[model samples]
Target: METVVMRVEELQLGKIVAEDIFANTQYPIIYKNAKIIHEHFRIFEMFNLKEILIYKEKKLEVLTEKQIEVETTIIKLSNYTSFETDYYDAIAQIKREFGNWQAGAKIDITKVRGMIIPLIEKVLEDRSYIFDLNSYSNAKDYLFHHCIATGLIASIISKKLGHDRGTIIQVAIAGMLADSGMAKVAPRIRDKQSALTEIEFAEVRQHPYYSYLLVKDLPALKEVMKVAIYQHHERLNGSGYPKGEKMSSITNFAQIIAVADVFHAMISERLYRLKQSPFKVIEMIKEEEFGKFDAQVVQALVDIVVDLPIGTKIELSNLELGEVMFINKYAPTRPLVKLINSGDIIDLAANRNFYISRVITKEY
Candidate 1:
């Protein structure tokens, strides 16, 4: 049978696989001759299958000329927009739920799980989504965006840390709800544009305990997750709030959420602070906030960002376009970049001024 190499984003329903697809697993992810369906999109993304060999539709020739054109158009129209569409929808839902929680409603674990599960699944399938999450957020809705992005980042970290599927989902939910207690705080404090007074900051710091209280009674949530939600704000050097607990006292899961939470918050555009590049933020987490986070968790994040393959398109902090040529082993974030305009190779490690601002392409 004849087959065509089609980009995964351009795939539509009912295309038959022409060859087996593998992604570092022992067996093929999708067997040859298998027909594609809606779920296959996530699988394709999960494996980062950019293009696949698929058997061409012989049935198209049997249809009318106009019908054949429509079929081709349909195939062209199908793309990777579903994840973004679902993400915005989830954000809107989270905003509504946060309002409900602020209005004295009970914590809805089931609803919260429903909101993040699909999103988690999608991001897990294609982690590149997590790197671009900050773009989806705005200052006005920073709180809502932070909750969702934190969950997604946590799920990625947990997965990288070798957590099982169930635990990863739980961690993601916990990350999303870690700040849920902020709902209980007065709106004047939660939504304030200016800096908070010591009195108000103290009130804000109580959010962790309040978050724990909100989820403590939920039997569906695991005990570890409850603890993680409560302690996510706690730092490693005994400086964290609600309980100022140090190294050995903190759960590893909580640290995972903590790194994820801080990473998203720092990288995201907030009401008071300008957003920093993800690469720069990762550097700060390692060098500046050294003793505040778990080493393993921070390394996991570094691996996630600096694992950029050679030839990946990136935008530098100076608004220059370049393609990564080499990743410095010791300082992976500062790689060798060949500027697009000058066609000159600039070693970022030597030139400390510019850093990778963001990835421009969808896939590395």
Candidate 2:
């Protein structure tokens, strides 16, 4: 029988696997010709069995035995510990403060360090586990995700520079609270989809200063913590807001937060525009704003996203579905992909026969 390849999108849920869909995971032949209505499906759940052999032909053909590999790769990638229970609790408290910022409820700046430090240590220890906050689909979840991502990135940088644990935690807290001033802005203005007028942009730029002023007088959070609220927006080229201080004047802690903040914002889908894919965003950072960010820090981030695992589903330039099987670490934009229907894994990095035109959707 001539082998026929089918895209996962083209295959129905009930369609029997003409061949072993994968070595470890397999589906029953009864699903042959079954239509798939949803874009996302758990292969294990759909099979109703842990593993089975599947054939790709029109009829059922058991090719080989299979096993379901239970691995918490994502969870294990980050060094999660039960010790951070209090940290998680602190974030919930901070979120509550954000809800009542208008009623004169102040964010507990001292408590911020406790929650942010361990998260940063985890990010530094295991680069793979830094969740991309910008990848979230819902705008309502952005605030929490942003805080997490920021803390993770900041902590990684601090550890790289050999900062002590106490100092690293303080810096991470700064990164987490960098955008606290946004709470003061009206939801309508912050969530507007259209281009902001000059007045609006000015108001947006004042958030860092406003945040600094709000907590600058607190004795517990007087000096170091203020950096988190004030200097986050400052850039090395003096293009950033408030005082327009040059890069030399910004603290190393603040610089790390700035990089993380910009990265999260660029990749995150926003009301005003679609989010850029991780590779594309990294490219823009390297080409257009290299001077604005620490080169070592940016390179570390680039390395993390470029080497994401194979079998990861991604949106392609043609609005088709595919999985990453290989990556050209040197040129991350061009990666080897296996088209869902074709099951043909093409190595764009080597074949030179095809090119990845563009990225349609990012892998979360």
Candidate 3:
């Protein structure tokens, strides 16, 4: 038997494991040679397996030849985005960790810190992968996908704010688990495709409190982190929930997580609604009418992410298409763009009337 190293993301759904996979911890033998499933990736990530051996000999009737060719191309090119891999593996680990927490597994603060710090570093080094992963998240569960995105977005904001690594990691963990309360809600309600009744909506709003209770007594986890998780839903202007605490009353950590959570949630796909484009969401966040988030935190996020999808085509408020040309540091949300039709350069920062409606496509 021959084997090749393949990242879990690179694994084809119909592929077979060429060798046994193992976890370094208590659950050592993950599985023997078997067909792969999406859940397998979560298990692989718990122990941080970068690559697994897969039996490439089996033909995948499920996938078209072109799909297989593209997979092979990605592998052969060695086109690695280490950050992207880290970002995904983080989600996988969260699935396992959160499952444990909900199933009466004690919140092991030391273990969680160990698992999440590396994940934060991956995003701090580069946050573009959050957008990349979100795009690929069409098939991912909203809960898992949004948790990881919140974690990544929070850490990126922390990095932009010049927080020390220790502080940043704390915020990342809080962001990752901020909505753990949602796990306690009935799946039927949580997964509902239509608007919830007022009673149902009230239940939905209790999630922050549930998350708070879950981690409140973990001796190893900082009190600050617990507070952040509890208050992540609160707003600066006191419009948010659980407890409508005002801006000055909220901790800075909680404030940062709040901003990240909303941004990631809106940009991510949900069963009930289509996901908003990154540009459009960011624009909404920056507008005066939606000015509930911490101004500094929002700008920090804007500074880090605005010019991120460079070279992507964007639609304007008036529906004209233009290619993003350059970023103006003064106006991170708007960039220098050239009209697709006229080839004329427009500085979006200079023209307040013109703003990106939505990003058409990312360069990657």
Comparing 2 and 3 by TM-score, which wins?
Answer: 3
Pairs in steric clash, model 1: 46-125
Q: What's the distance in Å from true for residue 321, model 2? A: 6.6
TM-score to native of every candidate shown: 0.78, 0.62, 0.68
Q: What local lDDT does model 3 show for residue 12?
A: 69
Quote the lDDT for 210 in model 1.
87
**Per-residue lDDT of model 3, residues 1-364, tens digit only:** 5667788767766576776554432212334466664445544553457887776564535555555444421101122355557656766776787778768676666766766676676556545455554575653477887877787788889888998887788788788778877778777788787889999999999999988887888766689889989988888889888889986888889989988888877777777677766766787788842658878888887766675333556778888988765555556677777799997767777788877766553344
Residue 261 miss distance in model 1 (angstroms): 0.7
Cα lDDT of all candidates, in order? 0.84, 0.61, 0.71
Where in model 1 is the C-alpha error above 4 Å?
1-79, 362-364
**Candidate order by TM-score, highest to lowest?**
1, 3, 2
Question: Candidate 1: worst 10 consecutive residues by lDDT?
Answer: 70-79
Per-prediction CA RMSD (Å): 11.2, 12.9, 19.0
The digit string of per-residue lDDT tens for model 2 on 9-87 reads 4443433443423322122222433332221134433333343333355554422222112211222332334324533
